[model samples]
Target chain A: MPLARRIIPCLDIKNGRVVKNVNFHHGTWDAGDPVELAAMYDRQGGDEVVFLDINASWEQRSATLDILTRAAEQVFIPLTIGGGVTAVEHVRSYLRAGADKVSINTGAVKDPDLINQSAEIFGSSTIVIAIDMKRRPTGGWEVYLQGGRTPTGIDGLKWAEEAWRRGAGELLVTSMDADGTRNGYDMELHQALANLVDIPVIASGGAGTLDHIAEVLTTGKADAALVASIFHSGQYTVDDAKQYLAAKGVPVRR
Target chain B: MAARIVIVDYDMGNLQSVRNAFKAVGYQAEISPDPASVLHADGIVLPGMGAFGNGMRKLAERDLIDPILEFATGGRPVLGICLGMQLLFEYGEEYGGGPGLGLLTGRATRLPDTVKLPQIGWNLVEPVAAAHPIFEGLDQPYYAYFDHSYAAADVAPADVAAVTDYGRVFPSVVARRNIIGIQFHPEKSSRVGLQMLTNFGRIVCHSRSTLR
Candidate 1:
């Protein structure tokens, strides 16, 4: 069989606590402690866990590292930490703290060289470039930065190609339009990115049901599906999602 | 006494996770750069990430290559993980190609172009040698997390303990007497991975008792 499609549970953290928000803003609520939630996901057979420091401030950066250290102790699966990663030192600090990979968004947009430099220093596999994309009013998606607050006029597809060329090992593409709706992933958006890049693309944003996830991994051509609200809201556990995927003929690790 | 398992730190990548994984499995593992410590340890774990050429260069610069070889050939158990596992082979065809540690008789080559590069995520591992200690208490065709683009290509069938398929069948687990190499990161492979570490610890203890 080919590689099993990954099911990743994302923990949106703020001030050392896991939080959930819709469309990157509004209705933010406490999910649980980051460490505990990560461990739970790991036990549930989550292919990977992501702790995104949604509110990545200078003071709270250490909190992220603290959570990572504690999670690394018990969670034996791959842990990816993202948010406010701007320099090689930030990547180094996360890796030293036991992060398997570091995801960079705004930093990579601000200095495209950050991807090249960090990848060169710490192998390309260690760097994950997260591109937050919003559907443009005139068609075609555009890249968003600063936690989805600022928008860059560059085309999302074009940026993805550049990021891959500059040494991004994987691309985490999140659709802002479909985010938090629980409707489904933007299939067209993900399909376009997946077809364009040779690297693995993780589909994020809208994942309401198991069928949505299976669709994204299959029709959307995504290598993995990143689910947050659905898992955090108790609508489905990682095991439930994996079983459903397996029953649907999607090859999962189980 | 517990076995002294020193994880060789050659500045390749994160050793803390490897040590943490060992700790989670009820074993104490220390990350050390001192060659003498590695040479004297009851068991040595070579863990790494990144390109094969860069990994070899780092090992050479830190003067760990010779000590590791001596320890492996000395009949003490030596386990290599991920890039560290690839380093056990004779050569690697990545980043301009370079010589490996030559402990195993295969060369590391890139996965076929038909499949995705860096074949990240979990895949099934089928034990070829059921008697190998690493497969103890583990089910056949178990799943392990793998994250690599290159794998052992021309390994002797006698040395391959397990195999995983991507674009084609490759040696996912290779064992030759006291030396074993796992292309997957057992440290990140959850309970099954932890069991493998425990099995390695048992092997270390068994070797120590027999030596006495």
Candidate 2:
């Protein structure tokens, strides 16, 4: 049989707490405990859970690790941690703290070699290069950093190709324009990136209805879809999204 | 006394999670690189993740190669998971083809690139044989988590316990006498995975008692 298209719930963590209204400059508001929400997602059959610590400090990173350590005990599925991860040691520490994988966003774009070195130490499968992008006014997507605050002017597709060549096992492409819009995923952006890389592409950012999730997997050719508000605000359960996708003949783990 | 299980650690990855899974099944498995501990164990759980070549180098670095071969040949139970399963075979093609422990007759090769690499997610595991100590209470077509880019190729049919597919049918579970290998993370695979571990635990205990 074919592999199931994964439904991953993303938890944007700040200072060790799950934050909902996070948009770079305005500051983040606490939503719930990171570990508790992760365990709940685990029980709800989230194929995987992503914990992105936005704008975290050295101390807050450790605190996030504590949450991951606690969550790993209860959450049986894979847990991926991101944010403030620039060095190889950060990847090591997070994996030790029970993250099955680590996503490198700004760090990778700046150093580039950081992706290769981390992949060498932790294995490519454990290293995910997350490309946060904003559609350029001219054309193409530009890489964004610092919680999507700063634009690096790096071409998203070129960077994704380089990251893959540097040994990134997966690519997490998030569209800043569509993020939190509830309009739907940036299918054209995700599809273009997904086509560029042979590795798994996790389509992230805008996720509204069950159709959005299904459309990204089928039309965008995303191997997995990541959603946040829909699952967090109790608008839809992970299972409901999964059942809807499965009924649409898109294979999903039930 | 409970069976003394050792989870061989070579810095491959996921060693702690593997130990936690065994612990959850009521076995206090030691995570050790010491050859003596491996030799003394009633059963060995070789847990690994990452590239095939790197894993072999780690085994050689820790001087675990010969001791593991001896333990497996000595008729004690041994279970290999994921990359650990691939390590049991004769060769692996991830990052270029190289020799493995050579306990099982096969080569681990990359899955067809048509499907996404690392093929992460749950898939059905169907037992090839009617009876095995590991399949205990599990029904056919049960889902187990899989996160792998490669699968064992040219394995002896008689030794394969279960098979799963991701663009192609590949061995999911293989067993021969006291040696067994599973290409999924039982710990991260939830309840059914724990149940499989429990069954392996029972096999360990039974083998220990019989030996005594």
Candidate 3:
């Protein structure tokens, strides 16, 4: 009846290798080979896998693309590649390399029209605008860029609306405050963004337990949850997460 | 000889994944824009992404329309995926209306406004025909990855092989004779999807033997 909420295991890749970070920076560790890890996730019944090229210089970006080409060969489920994608050509290259979708973070914030242009050429569904949000010292949240290092004065809620109007198919919102904390997702952030945009919102950051996932998908109203450390550390398999969700009455593909 | 499967390439999105999926199932498919290759293939897979109008225009530009149309009627398992599936219909209401291949008796219309556009993610595909070969070994109401805003609406009831609900029940899989159109990406739908592709491969092999 209803569309199943997606559980996407995000592979934060550095130099063509999978890595996990704390709060988008500290306590980084190598996970494994990107292609092998992706295939493993697919076998484990992951709904989708994201390869975020975390320090994607030109050489590393090419390396990531090579990984995607190889990963697409084995991983039969959807694969989304993100990070350091600034131009339309980058989007084209990723898709050609077999990425189902290309996510743009800083690229979108710098040139909001990149959303309009890429969505026009490649169709909206292929363009995912990843927004990294941090709670401002004041009350609301501000959008961050450059792997959540630079804070933009733009309001996170307003920027999401702009991206949607520009024809972004989905929003991958990562909470800088909650990321790597292993506490929970920023429910307030996800609930607000999901309510503002009609497009699908993927809630990222701080998923310690199954209840946190259930909370986000139900009360948070997110269409998908992007998980990293839990699955990476062998603490939980994607199937384990889905089973827990299904037991808790969350509609996950089992 | 191995089944001469040709995936029509008219500059649509990544066809490598589709070919890889076939390879994973012990089949090799050639990606070609040549109409002659398409006409000669034992099976044809029309894979596409992006807008429907652009897809049709690209097909027309490459002089592939007639060959594909001919292949559809000539039998031998013609499969269309996503936008390729939409193009098999008579008309598409996307990008301000355009003519399709008219291989099936329906039009691609936008999903109801009740749901989000580009209903991206996995949804349950309930087999309407119950015995279609493409659904062999698949659990009924299996989860398949779908990503599109427009789907084949007003399809003939008998031609509908499966249906999935987003905003409303739309034709997720439609089949008539040797031609099959699937709105979901079986290549990206994991094992359930791979099973469908494997079944399609079997259908192609059986059809070839039948012709001989």
| Local accuracy of candidate 2 as per-residue lDDT tens digits, A1-254 | 76778899999887778886533445455668888998788778798899998745756677888888888777778899998888898888999999999999888988999998998777788889998899988889999888788888888899999999999989998888888888899989988987788788999888888999999999999989998988998899998998899899998877
* Comparison by lDDT, 1 against 3, better one: 3
Please report, in order, the local distance difference test score of every candidate based on alpha carbons. 0.91, 0.87, 0.91
> Docking category for candidate 3?
high
Top TM-score: which candidate number?
A: 3
Summed backbone clashes in each candidate are 0, 0, 0
Interface RMSD of each: 1.1, 1.7, 0.9
Question: Per-residue lDDT of B49-114 in model 3, one digit per residue for the tens?
Answer: 878999999999999999998887887799999999999999999979999999999999999888
TM-score of 2: 0.92
Question: Would you list the clashing residue pairs of candidate 3?
Answer: none
Give lDDT for model 2: 0.87
The window of 10 residues in a row where model 3 chain A has the poorest summed lDDT is A54-63
Residue-level lDDT of model 2, residues B51-126, one tens digit each, is 8999999999999999999999989999999999999999999887799999999989999977767777778888
Q: State how far residue A183 of model 2 sits from its true place (Å).
A: 1.7
lDDT tens per residue, model 1, B31-139: 9998999888999999988889989998889899999989888899999999999999999999899999999999999999898778878999999897999789985
